[model samples]
Target: MARNVNYGALICCLFVTSIFLGIFVLVPVLVALFAYPSSPSFSIDLFDNQALNMTRTDDSPTNLTIHFDLKLKNENKAIGLHYPDPQIITFSYFPNVSLLTILAEYKLDGFYQGNGKTRHVQGMVVATGFPTVLEGTDMIAFWVDLVGSYKYKKDRTKMHRVELGCLVGIDYISSKKMQSGFIGLVEPGLDSKLKKKPSPDYGYP
Candidate 1:
């Protein structure tokens, strides 16, 4: 009889141990598996120019800044800065937007130039106003500064459609704590180096 009682107790203990394990371990795993995947992205569009300035480049091109105020939509669902996904942000400008500057300068007149006339731009953006959750009806305001170098030449016309395109990495490092936006040019600027009777200082002979 004692042996029978001991066997029954062992069976009960084993069953209770399994139940506790399932509740503490397996259940949490299932929850995490279901909740780890999230969708985090937003849309953006160009608005009007805020401020822009132009100058003649010498041996070394000076860093000029062209400011613009942009409008974003559907920002209520924007994920944290650190999210793993490539977001597409583009900037479409009108004619005569040739002015360029650093995306963000730690010091005054500091910028980076890559390749011929391109620069690797990076900066932080903010969202303003109340956004309609899941409705894609959010309004975002932003100003972007394009930083690069340009050479000053005379009697030359620089006119064409400038398209600037970039991919924003929301979380390049943490995959949960960073966000980025890309910009592209839809219509470029058009200007010339004094076509008729070029200036003696800058006009080409």
Candidate 2:
């Protein structure tokens, strides 16, 4: 009887151990799958008007506040964004005066501020490292000020089309997989268009 009892107990222990091992291995796969699982499509939304007041009267430094309603959903989960680092938000404007592509970058930290505000953030971007999660929902509102400028196409004299947009990445492979959302257009202005110049090969960064 004693020997039989020992054998039974051994079987029970093995069963339990197998179950535990299976769970442990499965957990990591589940977490990784959550990180960036496959899906039919993903999208982000931008509000109609600019949230914070943007002033570019002088070249000292200007803050361009942007308010956005961002949402992301996958096959099984919804994700929210929390940016601890500087995320790049790009604006492309073709002025009626310049024939060059005028690109502006706004770096920012974002949050969900109320009163139609996601959070009281400061910078030219809403947030970085977006879609930080796989199954959650968050309301994000932030601002971006024109802190500085970089010449993308140079020749700031010819007329061209100006469109506002952004550049985003996921899975650490930036530029390669970028999420760009079109915001608006820039009418005839100082930084009108791209000069007769050759633009960079790919729109990544």
Candidate 3:
């Protein structure tokens, strides 16, 4: 009789342990396997100092041609991104504390980005109508907005739209024609709803 009782207790303990493992360990692993990956990262690079200088010919408006490299990195460990063709990029300038003026729009050819990989896309845009406030200023700040749709390589049937934005400011000395590199912070997250305007904390006054 004592031997049978001991066997019954052992069976009960095993059942309880199995339940605990299922609730604590197996459940999370399964949830992670099906969840979406982390959002991708983005940055911009301005290699040429002259890219920011405005030029004019005859009666033509002040032409500001900017050459930049847009960098996109997939942060996922196992998932990849499929960006559709013709991504739209908008360049704008601030005429005042509350006014944003559109300068130019450029379209970039899209491609695939593998997990844990980065891609540098070369882009250029010719913008006119620079605000008088930029004249003789030591620093100029502008807004860069990117809008595109992408699909997960793991699930290509569904396409998701993403909007990314950042503010780039450069300092220059008009006497020497020298300029500092571009610096800005790309907003976090993967959609337009997650984007926030630059505040005083980000050097936007």
Candidate 3 lDDT score at position 88: 83
Best-to-worst TM-score order: 3, 2, 1
Badly placed stretches (over 4 Å) of model 3 are 1-34, 47-61, 134-138, 172-185, 188-205
- Candidate 1 per-residue lDDT over residues 37-134, each given as its tens digit: 22211222222221211222355234323232232221122122121122233221111123211122121232222212222323323221111111
Candidate 1 stretches greater than 4 Å from native: 1-8, 39-57, 61-86, 91-205
For model 3, which pairs clash?
Answer: none
Please tell me which model should have the higher lDDT, number 1 or number 3.
3
Cα RMSD (angstroms) for every candidate in the order listed = 19.2, 17.7, 9.3
Using all chains and alpha carbons, the TM-scores for the candidates as numbered come to 0.22, 0.27, 0.62
Model 3 lDDT per residue over 112-135, tens place: 888779887787777655533444
Report the lDDT tens digits of candidate 2 across residue range 1-205: 3444688889999999999999999888877555543321222333333432222234623333234433322233333232223434443322222332323444544332111112322223432222211122121212111221211122332222222323222222221222345222222222322342222432544
Query: What range of 10 consecutive residues in model 2 has the weakest lDDT sum?
Result: 143-152
Ranking by lDDT: 3, 2, 1
Task: Give the winner by TM-score: 2 or 3.
Answer: 3
**How accurate locally, in lDDT, is each candidate?**
0.28, 0.32, 0.63
